[model samples]
Target: MATKNVLIVLSSHDLLGSTGRPTGWYLPEFAHPYYVLAPHVKLTIASPKGGHAPLDPGSVEAFKADPESVEFVQTKSALWENTEKLSTFLGRAKEFDAIFYPGGHGPMYDLATDPDSIALIREFWEAGKIVSTVCHGAAALTHATLSDGSYLVADTPVTGFANAEEDAIDFSQYMPFMLETELNKISGGKYEKAAEDWASHVVVAKEDRLLTGQNPGSARDLAVVILEKLNA
Candidate 1:
């Protein structure tokens, strides 16, 4: 079997919706998946503008004790140091076997509305490649329209950072849009949640080539699911 190449897209937006707080890719969301998938597949990181993808300060501080997070931050991995612009890889979607997006409040500001991001996702889906995102990263699915002119996520079972979770964190008001509410309204799919906030909850829309995780806690599970689907 050939080695599977996975593209990981991160958000370039660094501000947290006028809160005057800084934000970027969630540390755990990217680290957990990177370690889980790195040993088995080739991983490439990209962002809207390229260069060093900003790190969410809170995420770094929160997971600072975790060795994986520590290693990610300390190592000068080329993936994070030299991110390619999403626009430059638009026509090369076929070169990858799967694409993953890691969550942070930042995705809500940029990846969610980036034309190239949405187009690349649609292209990967249309070509039968696996597409996955976790937490607010699900926002990236918001504007994806299929060739038939229907929302790519329409009627597909998916999960993302729930509104209740947002409420728990007390940051919903600062968000440009409610992640869960928007996902439900746009996808028209059954959006399920865990009984407790921050618990692992993942939904795989088998027929849609889509996989989504409910929050940062579900990051590893989401990566495992993608690996299973790819290996099967």
Candidate 2:
């Protein structure tokens, strides 16, 4: 069998909805999955503009205790230093077996509306490859349309950072749009969540072609699910 290759797309946007606060891809969301997937598959990191992608400072602080997060920061791998531009990877989706998007407020700002990101996702889905996202990374699916002009996530069971979770952080107001609300409205899918905020929750839909994690806590579990699918 050939080696599995995964494309990891990180948000390049660094602003937190005009709040004057800096935000980028969350540390654990990328670090956890990277550590889990790296040994098993070849991984490539990409972003909207390529080069260094910003890191969410709060995420770094919050996940500092995690070993993977610690190694990710201490090593400063080239994977994070020099991401390829998303545009360059478009139309080459078949080269990869799967694609993963890590979340942060940054994705809500950029990847959600990036034409290249949207097209790449649609291509991956159309090709029956695994497409997964965690937390606000799910925003990338917001505008993805199938060949039939229907939203790719429409009528699919999915989960993302819930509105209540956003409210709990008191950061809901700063967001350009609520993730859960947009997902519920746009996907017309059965969107549910864990009873408690920050708990791990994952939903696999579209016959495993679409997988989503509810929040940051779900990152590792989501990676495990991806590994299972890849090995299956």
Predicted model with the maximum TM-score: 2
What TM-score does prediction 2 earn? 0.97
Model 2 steric clash total: 0
Candidate 1, clashing residue pairs? none
What is the per-residue lDDT of model 2 for residues 15-54, given as tens digits with 9 covering 90 to 100? 8887889999999999888878989999999999899899
Q: In model 2, where do residues sit more than 4 Å from their true spots?
A: none
Alpha-carbon RMSD, each predicted model: 1.2, 1.0
Identify the runs in model 1 with alpha carbons over 4 angstroms from their true place.
none
Candidate 1 overall lDDT versus native: 0.90
Lowest-sum lDDT 10-residue window in model 2: 185-194
